[model samples]
Target chain A: MSGLLAVESAGALTTVQDRGRAGLAHLGVPRAGPLDRPAATLANRLVGNDPAAALLEVTWGGLALTSDTGVWIAVTGAPTPVEVAGAGRGSGRAEWLPAGGRLRLGTPVTGVRSYVAVAGGIDVEPVLGSRSTDTLAWVGPPRVQDGALLPVGAPHAPPAPLDTPRPPRPGALRVVPGPRADWFADGALDRLCAASYVVGEESNRVGLRLDGDPPERVRAEELPSEGMVLGAVQVPPGGQPVVLLADHPPTGGYPVLAVVHQDDLWQCAQLRPGDPVGFARLRGA
Target chain B: MDVLDLRAFGPAAVLAEVADSAAARSLAAYARAARVDAEEVVPGARTVLFDGVRDVDGLARRLADWTPDGGPERGPLVEVPVVYDGADLHDVAARWGTDVDGVVARHGEIEFVSAFCGFAPGFAYLAGLPEEHAVPRLDTPRGRVPAGSVGLAGSWCGVYPTASPGGWRLLGRTELTLWDPARYDPALLAPGTRVRFVPV
Candidate 1:
């Protein structure tokens, strides 16, 4: 049966997200999706939702909701204290929430984001074939707000067995030289790999502003704006590198020195402000 | 036909570096016409990015073999009615060594082509202004450039799809709705669409 979720507290920042709109960059649309793809996918799987189903992305946890129907739900991503009907429940497992049961998530202790997946997924109207909220372009569904009534779709299949293990900790991000690597000085990529950078406070879904020794540029002339891709490490005139994310603008003028491997980008979603990050060059790149 | 420098952009995409924005547009058109196996074929100032490729090697080989004869095929013409009363009209006149009337006449005469879209949704970078008449951006960007404000920066012409902070030299304004998400084709001036700024 279908259900409804009453938002009691929207937490720090919560938004609906799905796979996101693809192939629309020509019109300047950003591909806004869950930053932690694997975690979101696992949450969907645990709740028996389709991979393309829309779910909630909670930033720094603290989301509180009340379900109007008994449904299966799962929480993944950053480890947080999950409680249902005042009973503490473990994170990363499917849990039953009876009708009128209240679900609350405490602040995450380690990661920056958490994914909450219900059995049938969030039933918001899709825009451009996605439910993800693009902070850069402000596309897709609106951000979750307190006192909002969210419609839940009918259950598709029974909830998966509650035995999925949490994903292992990510290692150093792997990188390869980008198309505009020549714009930077010699050994710039090596220098980028050598230095340890911290996530800047201004970081958002658009990009991860990194604080570290800026990479020196060989070319002083303004580079014409070019198509930017996800995971691109674009170095601005200030020398600091900003790793473009899912909501990054379609094109940019700065030179890109390196690109983080797609498989490793999920680690960026969990990194909190001041989290130290390191990079490693791909073998033979 | 022009040879393009191809570079690998991450594992799933390829960036074809071209000489100029026109070449980038042409290459993007060529890729789309050839049905290149990619999720998105985006044209930029001097590059065409083929993203989400299933077979990167095969797509790269196909791109290498392409020899475009000329510019991209032009789309339908879009006539924009401009008021020619922007705040920077006198400033642009001083830069062009012409009077305000002269500037308006010259701008209305030229036929511009939508080269690509960026900076924001439905914001097309319209090209076609001659190199010598290129205009410089303002020393300081305005805090807010109203939606439909037609402006120029370095030879590239654009109309703000929505109210935003901009650095382009404002030439005039239009009433056309540049972006509407509910519309079938949200961007009124998509890439390759021919544009003409008719003085109102």
Candidate 2:
């Protein structure tokens, strides 16, 4: 009858996420929510939950859940081999789990994250019009810990046995040149469009630190600190690019080289460590 | 401030630059100029956001080509009570080659304006930290900076809305909650909101 599934095993970096808190960046709040927005939305729709309902965002894929009351739920994204009471969950799949039946999420197969949505939705106190967890500035609580009983609220409508799996990530990401695109040398734009960068080991929710050819700066003047956006790719002194993620800071000093298109944000979120990333030009229709 | 050219940020957002002493003043100007029909008008340390469902390109082009009415001289001053006791206070002064009083005076002299919001909710990027007062961030960032903590690094200053790990030197704390989600305006200080700090 409740909305939230109890946290039996809260894997690394698992947090409650929804559509994300926007329009508050002027107040210094970065939009922190599910890295894979489409997947979260799909999972929500499958369980007959609201589009903005909060679900568990499991990164590096390791989580387990059990319900106090029997509920219908669905698992999607990253092709995780989900098991409910010893049954497997595939892409675009829905299954019913009885009360106290264990729901487990194994390791990531294709992508790096997975979303598990309940029939109702997780009912946690929302901060700033959002139930999404922001760990960088303590805006929300840290990753869910073991033995934490999440309160599952009632669904807006009865559970639907519908199957709506998210579309697979596109092959390439369309990125727009940065506001400071002129800061780079003549060939910098070509290099950005030509090079294949890898997600470095030092990446996190705050930002994705990339490892690749260091681009030359055309205008190296010390820039005044300014506001940054989620998915803004800024290159530090070393020339490596740092892709700003959902939990990025309110402002930064580095020069932005490019910004990943909002549509491809899920692909950027699913990029595992050492994954190759090649930037493509964004063309308006 | 003169109206500059507009640039498209993304599918739903458009932005314009106001390369001035303080981005707050111009941001406020833009906010007032587009007062109506804007889904959201967000200002930051050095940028302003016009996000929503309208004609993003048309609005951006209009913003780039139109002149502003020079809105209120950006005069919403918020006096923050500080204790002047940050963990990195003493060291920051030394790096800037200034005495404690000198640092305090510089910190209070000019009114700081909200330029942008980014890292965390309610984290205001306060502009107007004098160039001389600016110092490089700590080599290794501090593990935690408490709520309402004032910090300075590089060319900007900021107040930690919540307890967060930061690299900026902390000089003091305040009782005022910069950000409380339950409130109508969660972040106490918003872009163009003047910040006037007074020692406790």
What candidate 1 gets wrong by more than 4 Å, as runs, is B71-73
Model 1: lDDT equals 0.90
Q: Candidate 2, residue B12: CA error in Å?
A: 2.9
On a 0 to 100 scale, what is the lDDT of residue B47 in model 1?
A: 86
Indicate the docking level reached by candidate 1: high
Cα lDDT of candidate 2 equals: 0.75
Which candidate comes out best when scored by DockQ?
1
Q: In order, what lDDT does every prediction score?
A: 0.90, 0.75
| Residues A1-285 of candidate 1: C-alpha lDDT, one tens digit per residue | 387999999999999999988988999999999999999999999988899999999999999999998788999999899999899998787999999999999999898999999999999888877888998878888899999888999887888856656556787889999988998889999989999999999988899999999998889999887888999999999988899998999989998899999889989998889999999999989
What digit string (tens of lDDT, one per residue) describes model 2 on residues A222-277?
Answer: 76555566678898998999988888875677888788887888887788889888
TM-score, chain B, predicted structure 2: 0.85
Candidate 2 chain A: 10-residue stretch with minimal lDDT: A158-167
